[model samples]
Target: MIRDLARSVREYKKVSIITPILISMEVVIECIIPFITAALVNEIKAGCGLNTIIKYGVLLILMAFFSLLFGGIAGSTSATAASGFAKNLRKDMFYSIQNYSFENIDKFLTSSLITRMTTDVTNVQNAYMMLIRVAVRAPLMLIFAFVMAFVMGGRMAWILLVVVPILAIGLGIVIYKTFPLFRKVFTKYDALNKSIQENIKGMRVVKSFVREDYEQQKFEAAAEDVCADFTKAERILALNGPLMQFCIYLVMIFVLSFGSYTIITSRGLDFDIGQFSALLTYNFMILSSLMMLSMVFVMITLAGESAKRIVEVLNEKSTLSNPENPVYTVKDGSIDFENVSFKYSEKAEKMALSNINLHIKSGETIGIIGGTGSAKSSLIQLIPRLYDATEGVVKVGGVDVRNYDIETLRNQVAVVLQKNILFSGTIKENLRWGNKDATDEELIEACKLACADEFISQFPKGYDTYIEQGGANLSGGQKQRLCIARALLKKPKILILDDSTSAVDTKTDAKIRKAFREYIPDTTKIIIAQRTASVEDADRIIVMDKGTINGIGTHKQLLAENAIYQEIYYSQNKAGDQDEN
Candidate 1:
């Protein structure tokens, strides 16, 4: 965990190293202050001249000023280091997530990743700052002050021997009891974040279903779980303050009562007023350091859980990685799956797709139709290597997908998946993701092919229109057309539309298919749709059923022979055949 986290500290390492050095200098100056005061007291006791006392007082002020100077520098440096560390941490996690296959992404919730990047990283940053500054200062201050106290008061310091041990043991027990509770508290935080994300993203559905009250109740339950766990943990942490104060006062009472008796009985010989005053200063310093140290302990306890969560993300190796020696160019759009069997998880009992053998030649247009569980999307996903085949080779352009550079392979195979996503940007910017250097005319051309140009031109901004996140500003059919335009802009060798045009009317869908046939004829097209009209003109159509191909033939052949295909065809045409006069 330590090594994993340290990787994010890359460029901030110099600042991190400098912070502790400044803190050490600060501690040295701070430890000198009480000694200077002791010297001033002795000067006054000896009836020294005013000049002598002022000189020691000046020295004391200088020590304090230097201590403050170092502290300020350390504060600024540690802040730079911690914030940089957090920035790098987020960058690292995000970069790692970019490489995750669909299967690896299934390992974590979107809410959990959000919590790790924001809340968990922030916690570690604060703790890191505390670790370099306060943790360094507290222990050093405590050790230095204790040595001075023992030097000044001798055997009377033994009182601390008993008192410090008792205080430390009690504090240790409190920390141990609360540590596990803090770990559980962060998991509840994940649940709370999950609720918030789900509610916000599905707000439209909640309001439409008139389940706003139910969502609010669910959110409250999750929030309350977080609150309850935090309350329990904080209540235990609260004991640190009173317990520390109790130990401080008990030690002070003992030190004073014991010091006064020794001074009076020794007849101004053993423990003088000057030494006694310095011992009192050192005593406060020691107890205060302990108090600050306890606070550091509390912060560490909280951050430990957050650190572990962060490390978990940073340590996750992307399940999909490019081969060391990889093919950089695709020869053609041809795709072949040989005896492919795949399951989302290694522990799964059944495969999502099994024994899939198919060959799609370049420039061929293939259509796929299936029921909900027939693995239509799963079969197409293998073409782009979105998920690798578990048992057999999946080849694109006559080369195994595993042998191609992942980015090179994916770039050639564009898939507008079942879920269409448009980022918050101008429509042109969203389309530019397909080809960053695409001219305005190229973008318009792609949209024209996707049947999106007419609707976009109707908007005030045309191609430059700002799209809200998820393209929430547009209607469902509009969003699908825009997404299709984005994919079309890629001009990929293989384009897989997994029910991407489901929102459009059949006529518009037919036009989009017509454009694909005319504009990018050499591109292998695999269209997955529920409607038979969407696939009727394809070179061939494949019927998928229960993770296997049930039939492969023209639409007319399937309508004549295949029972499942005939049933689906009749089911749709039966409705169309109805007339109202």
Candidate 2:
């Protein structure tokens, strides 16, 4: 895990190295300052000349200046290194997600990934900064100060031995108890973020259903879980402060009492006033360094869980990858499925699709109709290799999907999934996702085919009109039409519309289908729809039921011979007649 995370520090390696080096220099200078002060005091006590005092004072000032300079530069470099590491971590995680096959993405929740990328990354970033600077300074300061104290006060320096062990034992207990609580807290954070994400994304439905109070209560429950764990962790961590204070005062009392007695009894021979004062400075430095160490440990405990989560994403290999020697060009839109069976997960008890053997000729218009959960979308997703079939072969353009370069295969096979997503950008910008170099004429023609140009032209800015995230400003039909237009711009050899035109009126839907038949006849078009009218005009229609193809034939043939098709067609037509009545 450490090795995996350390890889993100790539370009910042130099700065990361420099930060600790500067911190070590600062610690050395700081330790020397206390010793210099003790000697200067001894000289003054002996009634030294003004020149001797001025020389010691100047030397001390120079040491202080160098310490400050090193400390300041270390702070800047540590910040730079930490921020760069965080950027790299986020970039790596995002790129990994982009490459992940649909099966891989399903392994992690959307909310969990978001938390790992944002909150978890921030926690690790702060810990990295402290690890580079304070972590280095604290240990060096403690060692140097302890050595100086031993040199000046002799046997009296042994007081730190007692305090150090006590503080170490206390910190160990505190950290051990708090570590589990912090781990639980971050898990709760994922739940809390999930609650907020679901609520905001479905705010429209929530309001329409008048479920504000329910959502609020749900959010509160998730928030309370996070707060409770954090509170428990904080309660345990609070012991560090009292434990440090007790140790500091215990050492202070022991040092002052012993040093004063020795000074009075030995007449300043064994332990003089100058040595006593320097020992006090060393005591503070040593204890404060320990205190810094305790804080660093606490931060590490918090970041440990975050680090694990981040490394999990970084180490994940996409379930689908290009072949070692991949075929780059798709011959045509031909699709063949032979004994294909698929389950969403290895642990799933039932296959989502099973025993599917079908063939689609290039440029043939195919329509699929199935009830919810019939795996209609699952059947089409395999064509583009979105999720590789768990059993048997799925071929596109006469080649197994796994044999083709992933990007090349996907570029030739365009899918407008059931969910229509429009990013926050100008209408033209969103359309450009399909073809980056598409000319204005190409854009208009594609929109016209999808029947999106009519609504887009009504906007004052036309194609340049700004679209809100997820196309919030547009109607459902408009969003669907625009998405279709974007897919149309791809000019793919195979286009699968997974119930994408459900939002548009039947007339507009017909126009889109007519456009496909007239303009892109050679492009194999597969449409998944609920309404039988949508598929009645297609060359062939597939009836799916419980993960298998129940019937495959022309619409008229299915209606004549297939019981399921008869039931669906007659029911929808009956409902339409009742509505007209």
Candidate 3:
């Protein structure tokens, strides 16, 4: 945990060092004021002249002013450092997540990732801020007070020695008991996050089924569990403060009683009553510092757990990394799979795709159709290297796909997935994401090619119209067209539509296909569709069944030669006839 924390801090080397230095200055200022107060009190006890006492009193005020000044500086610096650290960490984590393969991402749920990125990072930031602001002061104050006490009265310092040990034992117990509880709290937090996210995202289903009360009870149960664990941990750790105060009081009694006896018995007045009073002040300062240290321990325990969780993410090695010394470019869009097989997990006996062999030439429009989970999407996903084949080679441009730089290779393939996601932005802004430097004329042309221009122009603001989150304001068909337009704007060598036009009517789909033929030049198009009419005009159609290619041919050839394809075609046509009757 400490090593991970050191690594996290090292990410912002300059700021980390500067924050501690400022905090130290602040603590030194605080420690000096107490000593000046002791001097003023002793001066009055000795019957010092008014001028001397007044001078010491003014010095004490100056120390306090400096303390406040340094405290402000330290706080500002600490906050700045913590904020920057969190921002950079989050940025790095997001970048890493983007690089993760689909298989890797599947290991974590969306809600868990969200919680880690948000709540977990905030926890680490808070811990870092506390370390910078309070951690340095507590230890410095304790040491300074101890030194002052020794100088004021040697024998009186023994009380501190006894009291400090007892406080340490109590702190150790609190830490030992509470550290494990914090881990449990974080686990429960992930569960709570998952429950809330699922309920909110599926709110429509919840309302349709009238499960609101059930969901409320479920949420209440989770909250109650978390509350119970939190109370248990807090109850155990909360004992520290009262126990510390008790210890402090006991030490104070010992100091005062012993010091008074010494002052009276030692007639030589070697250690005067004035110094005895100063010792008491120093003892209180030390006790307060100890209390602050105990709180730091609790924070460190929680932060330690959080740090471990964060490190797990940062240290994860992506299983889909490109080969070292990878080839820099792909020459053409030709894709080939030789004996390609894949599975979601190694433990699974069955493969998602087995012994798949196919070759797609550059500029050819090929279609894939199959039953659900027939590996249609999985096959096309290989072209863009979303996941590597488990057993065989996937090649692009006559070279193994793994040979090309992952980013460079993916840039050449634009895929519109079955599930279309759009950011909150104007239509023009969303299109620009495909190609940041694309001109306005190019954007409009791409929109026209995707059959999106007509609907976009009908909007009140046209291309400048704002889109709600997830394109919620748009109809499903409209969203699909915009997604298609976004893909076209990329001008990629390979364009893949994985059931991308399912929401559009058959006529609109045909129009979009025709526009693609007119505008896109020499682009290898792979269309995965459920509608038979959508892919009937393709140069080749591959029908998949149970994770294997059942037949590969043109639409007419498949209708005559393949039983499964024939069945699917006849069934759909028969359904159309029945509807007409």
Q: Count the backbone clashes (under 3 Å) in each candidate.
A: 0, 0, 0
* Stretches > 4 Å off in candidate 3: 1-12, 25-36, 258-268, 346-349, 575-581
Where in model 2 is the C-alpha error above 4 Å?
A: 575-581
TM-score of 2: 0.98
Displacement of residue 439 (Cα, Å) in model 1 is 0.2
Candidate 3 per-residue lDDT over residues 497-519, each given as its tens digit: 99999999999999988877777
- Against the true structure, what is each candidate's TM-score? 0.97, 0.98, 0.92
Tally clashes: model 3.
0
Estimate, for each residue in 170-214, the C-alpha lDDT of model 1 and write its tens digit: 778888888888888887888889988988898899889999899
Give the local distance difference test score of model 2: 0.93
Alpha-carbon RMSD of each model: 1.9, 1.7, 2.8
lDDT of 2 by residue, 1-581 (tens): 99999999999999999999999999999988888898888899889999999999999999999999999999999999999999999999999899898888999989999999999999999999999999999999999999999998899999999999999999989988988888888778889999999999999999999999999999999998888888888888888889999999999999889888888788557677888999999999999999899889999888989999999998899889888999999999999999999998899999999999999999999999988899999999988889999999999999999999999999999999999999999999999999999999999999999999999999999999999988999999999998888988999999999999999999999999999999999999999999998988998999999999999999879977998888888788977456545
Per-residue lDDT value at 29 in model 1: 83
By TM-score, the better pick of 1 and 2 is 2
Candidate with maximal lDDT: 2
Per-residue lDDT value at 267 in model 1: 57
